[model samples]
Target: MSPRKKIVQAAFEKKKLNGVVARVGLVLDISGSMRNLYLNGTVQEVVERILAVASKFDDNQTLDVWIYDNEFSRLPSVKENGIENYVAKQILNNETLHKFGRNNEPLVMEDVIRKYTKEEPSTQPAFIVFINDGGVVKPTKKVIVESSTLPIFWQFVGIGNSDFELLRKLDEMEGRFVDNANFFHLDDISAISDENLYDHLLHEFPEWLQAVKSKGLVL
Candidate 1:
């Protein structure tokens, strides 16, 4: 085997996933559309799995949860949520711009950008997972464009049948676009299973992670 393969094997033997991580910033679409049961579970199921898996990374990583909508634009900030807030503000910006409430208080995309441009932070390494139904309002594009430049690494997963085409397109050109790769996916939840989710996440997560780190970002 190659020397690199030998080294990795030895590392695995020693149970060292040093650079490989577990904690992550999970963003799910709690919009009205998510309630449309696409599979055995709604998009919520995926978020649950994400949280569960993060727990396994206890030694190396932690998972933070953030949900978005108008009245509930954020699911308690990750900062206050107790996990590292490296990407909290960026997620908040994307949340406000790229999301509308399922019920109340709509904050336009410009609002998020106007806020972010005024304050930029160090780009941290993070598994920015976006679970959305591409049904956001049109004007939100401004928010998307503005905040899109913020994240250093991402895992954009689209749930349901919302124009996967458009959703994938709005993503950064060099952005963390997963194009159905393991880290990223276009899931029709109705036809999926937990096992399927677990296996894919396990198999695909590592490589996408490697790609993100290759860019020289820190999580």
Candidate 2:
């Protein structure tokens, strides 16, 4: 097994998520402010790391990918087999895809909801890893609240030192059937070790899974 897969598996075992199954999705912020991160290969590294989690969590070992600014593009799903140079080939080289623009979290978020809840519809839960540098809008709260009852958990990660007030307050947000989201800030994601990163990523997921299952959100 690849080193990342081993780390992810070890994290799963530590979290007691050995037998859990879920569809994995990655939402990358392609807003104008995020241009540097993309150009510097930070975004590519993010894809590779998340793909490691997907390889273990999803039955098909595939991760559905989406990049968003003001608009969003649902790029092809990525699998373990062709993970190398994925961001460069599937994203940077693709002329048809959307790149840096403005931040519009709700637009892409709704489409993610549509995919797991409507288009593909699965008995397994959907685990969405949302990455952003900042500039979160208020409408994002509405989307998270509305989607709370569904079998989806949003793990929002803020990269860099920017104003993430709204995302930071997700844990306190109310009026949801269940708490369906988590937020963590990392000034520099690449600096973190894989083991620590995996631990942070999977931190709140197991509790969310237990809550959702008890409420019959997932069978």
Top candidate on lDDT is 2
Residues 1-219 of candidate 2 have per-residue lDDT tens digits of 878878998999999999899999999998888888888898889999999999899999999999998899998999878878888898889888878888899999999999998998988999999999975889999999999989999999999999999998998999999999999999999899999999999999999999999999997
Location of the lowest summed lDDT over 10 successive residues in candidate 2:
79-88
- The C-alpha stretches of model 2 lying farther than 4 A from their native spots are none
**Can you write out model 1's per-residue Cα lDDT over 1-219, one digit (the tens) per residue?**
544334433443344444454445566665656544422244444544565455444334355555566643335423323433333344433534444347221252333233223443434434445566654555444444434344323455666556655445543433323312223455574466555554544554465455545544335
Count clashing residue pairs per candidate.
10, 0
lDDT of each: 0.45, 0.92
Instruction: Quote the lDDT for 98 in model 1.
Output: 47
lDDT of 2: 0.92
Q: Over 4 Å off in model 1, which ranges?
A: 1-19, 36-44, 58-62, 70-72, 76-124, 135-151, 169-187, 202-205
Consecutive 10-residue window with the lowest summed lDDT within model 1 = 103-112
